[model samples]
Target: MAGAVTTVTTLSNEARPKHLTEPRPVRYLLIAVALLFIGIVVVLPMLTVLLEAFRKGWSAYIEALKDPDAMAALRLTLITALIAVPLNTIFGVAAAWAITKFKFRGKNLLVTLIDLPFAVSPVISGLVYILLFGAQGFFGPWLMDHDMKIVFATPGIVLATMFVTFPFVARELLPLMEAQGVQDEEAAVSLGSKGWRTFFKVTLPNIKWGLLYGIILCNARAMGEFGAVSVVSGHIRGETNTLPLHIEILYNEYQYTSSFAVASLLMLLAIITLVIKGLIEGKLARSRHGQ
Candidate 1:
């Protein structure tokens, strides 16, 4: 029994310490560093904005919210997101379907082209639109001759946003569709269902959550877009201004409090989007389990 106890003790001593007892200091150091970084970078900046937004009291907050230009900017931002997100969602779904469900020549080339915008800078994208629609651009004179306006306008803003957000939904949907496979689609077709019917009934159900998630991402990007919008937008107040652009103008004019107020609103929107995305992913999980 003494020998047995000695052998067991020897084996236990030979084993390295488990995680709970091993290097407690290192774990605490890592956690301290992470907390310090979060406090300095994220928490401090957010608190500053919150304080600025409410500095003049609740009445000032209400006044800023009710400002006509602010209201208009908010409305325009929502409208542009509404239009752009849907268009991109449709394009994304179709592009994903073609890329994943079909085998064709130049397939790789086409996908590379579709993902091109992601590699390109937003400023470059804005420049491309300017070259296409600006006064001295290729189509500029012709468009002007017809009394058309694109640059420095709402249409230009939407187009720029759409360009930037084009990849979101397609990128999201492609993997999901590819993984789900063509078996269900083949089975549907075999049963005499038409292509569109099969897609809506069989394919869409499986990828709906993913599609919604992409749309949410697209919407957020559209609403918060600044660099490209600033390039094309003349920054016309209440006319062509988006919320982000409005915030920029406010800051440039030294209205720091108002700037952070609008920024806080946008931050709230971003948080809401995250919440929605979480809900969507949860629903998707439940759906897969149900299947």
Candidate 2:
């Protein structure tokens, strides 16, 4: 019995290291599979669009670039993004501050409502705007009487984009703020720092990266927004058209090359956003490490 026990113990010890080492093959296999899927689904499609954009050479590119309607769409998209992202960022910060820094009744419900856009269909959101602002819809008659327009106009587009991007900044900042706790704020208060000063000097520095990340995401979504904007935009050519809408128009008109070109432009913007976000996150990480 003693001899058998000794043999089993020796075998168990020998097998343990091999068991740990053998699992590495499974890990590598999973990583390779993930990469393969990403390449096939995302990388390949992006490459295809890039190639198609340049398919017609520099002259076509220049022509598309010079198209007044295309320029207008680009301008409108930028303008909407400029307006919407800042507004959303402000709202997000306020929402995050309220929800994370204070405890109140129905707090969870409020947070859930703020995040409702994530689950609500963009089409439905657009329709709701239309119902509220359309000429024949609920408040539409009053708005018309007051000579105000919301649907089928720039303001409508901005509002729709705002609705869609509303939760981004808050979602990004909420957890970060919660994790940071109110200790710093309390310390600042104890030191007699004013609210705004404490927020700018203490709170802002800690979560700036996360805030910026959310802003970038908001801007990207605002720029690329299609479904909701389309529903309310009325596709009024240079007047109300955005880049994504313009791309759709081009595609429908069988301007395949131009569609791809515009798509490539959007893709480039997305890549730039991602790069900026990565840089911000890296800086944040390094800052934390240094601290």
Candidate 3:
């Protein structure tokens, strides 16, 4: 009996993957390689942006950011995020709830459409809006007749941003909502709770962290989006240019310090987003474990 038990133990150990049983040296080497890669890809570029932004002096860096065009770009970027993030968050939550908590016709189609933005390139996404709204395009005459402009205007910029960042929140929540299942929602319904009550009480608490995570990612993408916004913005300097487009204009005009200074703002935003995302992820992990 003891020999049989020993054989079972040996077999179980052997069934584990070799990588999981690697030597300490190999483990340390892998960790070192991962750290090196992150340093090269992420940390180095951030440091470079900061270093170059203030290369001249603190005064120059401050002056660069205080430029009228730069301030305009900053405000435009903020307005875009303020409009885009909340709208996408609402859409994402609705899409996630519909796809996860209920079953209906065209479910697969709904999911595919949710993923459509990710499958398409940013530049192509911009061009699609232009084709629909450009002065020479399909709705051009109708829009002109109505004296309404959608392309190469603020509306165009917002639309492009919405398209590019559409997938982030939904994609984040889909798998999470799926894993939580529908039992809790069903219980709430059986207990005489209304739809919105159940959602606000039971559903929201369960998925809040995942929702926040998705919102952060969505906001980050919206603010940093360049290709799509650039194509539709007409780069009208202070009028339509967002921060990324403004940075490009500055760089093109050989204003390296100013460009880096503007770039630094984006870099700071990215860093803050990453930090918040990490904290939210930690909270999410704890909540899941508690469940």
- RMSD for each of the candidates: 10.5, 10.3, 8.4
Tens digits of per-residue lDDT for model 1, 17-82:
576464878868998999999999988988898899999888888788788989999998999899
Tens-digit lDDT track of model 2 for 76-162: 999999999999999988888888888899998997888788887889878989999998899999999999999999999999999
RMSD in angstroms, candidate 1? 10.5
Of 2 and 3, the candidate ahead on TM-score is 3
Q: Which of candidates 1 and 2 reaches a greater TM-score?
A: 1
Q: Order the candidates by TM-score, highest first — what do you get?
A: 3, 1, 2
Worst 10 residues of 1 by lDDT: 1-10
Q: Rate the local accuracy (lDDT) of all candidates.
A: 0.84, 0.85, 0.88
Ranking by lDDT: 3, 2, 1
Cα-based lDDT at residue 255, candidate 3: 95
TM-score of each: 0.89, 0.89, 0.90
Q: Judged by lDDT relative to the true structure, which candidate is superior, 1 or 3?
A: 3
lDDT of 1: 0.84
Candidate topping lDDT: 3
